[model samples]
Target: SIEGYGIHGNSAEWSIGTSASLGCFRLHNKDIQKLFSLVPVGTPVQIVYQTVRGGIDLNNNTAWLEVYPDIYQWSNPELESAKVIQSLGWIYEPHWQALGNLLQAKKPLRVEIPRVIKIEGESLDIDGFYWQQQVYLSQKCLEVLTVNFKTLRADELFSGFVKLDTTDLPGGNSQYFWDPQANTLRIIRLKVLLNGMELSDAASWSSDHRLLMNIKTIAAQLNAKFDWDCVSKAAICNEMKLVGEPRDGVFWVELEGLQRVWPQLKSTWDGKNYTLELMYKKR
Candidate 1:
């Protein structure tokens, strides 16, 4: 276990979400008290960081995306935003000019898109938004999909298409498809994995419907060695070194190291914005 790091109460509410802590994640006193009592000892904890946060605006029930400052200068915000949108199985031409303007002006901005939900060739008159590759449907849509189809439950509904090795799943049989142009996200079956090892049980669900996985577990499953240098606060994996910052006692590293181990991951910059793509080898 790492020393000088943990999740605890902090009086600095203004610095709650910012990178202002020494190493540990800070929660409100009341919140931390409640969390401490509910969580058992020795429970595994993992922290996942993303520059682009996506969710639905509860008041309006519309989809929204937030681009956080790249304080570490490790990622391209535009590309990260695009990736988040793509992960949601969205197939729409982005407003690059408007996005650029917002980025340049450094102003708080919100843009709404007219979206239609198409499921299995039938368009449903329901409002939904995609976040972290999962679809958040309205109560009406959930009822209709679960009651009429009798295939998806309130908890089982997800993006229609998932890309994974079926051997990793129980019973060794599952069907998943993702078609952004078709506008369909129905999770017939799902099993989260890393390099064919099951990680479904260890995954954590966020309030915004995103799944968070432990990086150490992921590193081990990928056959990569992971270690943290407590003195320097650096994370080392397979000879690649990245300076990490502590959040609730765990070191967080940038995504650059991923490209080192995963050779199929590619990124290209065309003098404007970066494009990231994952290539798979044919069997």
Candidate 2:
């Protein structure tokens, strides 16, 4: 005989949300009445209990797993461990490792990316000196603006012949030249006069098909000692190291890498052309 088994009486009352009886399952008077109307006799009843829960919200890129206190006196170790492991199924090992590494490094995680890139001006300039060739901008170029090295051809900047040595590699030959007199190597290519005068009609080109000549060639002509470092996968110029790696048989180095290594080198871009100046002294 349950208190809610029958119709209303003078002492009838309702209690819910917690245990309110000693030996019988109980519900509010209205709930019991509704259940009695909807369920027939001999219907089956099942009960469920939960101690841990988890959920994933991919839209927000977030997830959580929680373990709740056991309200009942039952403290089965196996059951508790199973519930905790079930709740943790939403997390993966790699996610945990990455999170741990970030914590150890003490760097904040970044999710947003830049939307726009702003340039200072048109015409690439070095110091105040500007190149003759027009500078162009594109995502395809290593740096924002790329200009032909021939634009830098001038008697004041470059003169005298510099010898270049060549050696064969897997796809092509490893080629470089350095001045025997100086510790630095002066890079030179086609269109560049040797010994302050034109010597040959042959010219050298770069692999990216954008730059007028390979940077290594220019570096050698500039009297900057340049070499490839296999271990670090970069280019070495005197004391400066430029990040570089070969992509599709073409060794690629960003224009920014060159600028970083050569502090005297200055560049700017006008709307149509690039300006470059090689400042021999610090400004």
| Candidate 2: regions farther than 4 A off | 2-15, 54-68, 76-283
Candidate 2: C-alpha RMSD to true structure equals 23.1
Worst 10 residues of 2 by lDDT: 166-175
lDDT of 1 by residue, 1-283 (tens): 6565788887787888777987788998999899999997567788766667555454654456676677667888778766766665544543343344345424333444324444342345554443334444444644333222223334322332222221222111122234554655433322343433455322322223232333454566566688877689777777777665543345544334555545553433221211122232322
1-283 in candidate 2: lDDT tens per residue? 5443332222234443344555345666666778778888656656556544445555643444344445574664235534544565533221222222222221222211111112233232211111111111222222322223232222322122111121210111111232222222222222333233332211223443332224475565567787776567776777776666544333456546766766666543331222222333345
List pairs with backbone clashes in candidate 1.
25-248, 160-185, 160-186, 161-177, 161-178
Question: Each model's C-alpha lDDT?
Answer: 0.48, 0.37
| Residue 50 lDDT, candidate 1, scale 0-100 | 62
What's each prediction's clash count? 5, 25
Instruction: Using lDDT, give the best candidate's number.
Output: 1
Candidate that scores best on TM-score? 1
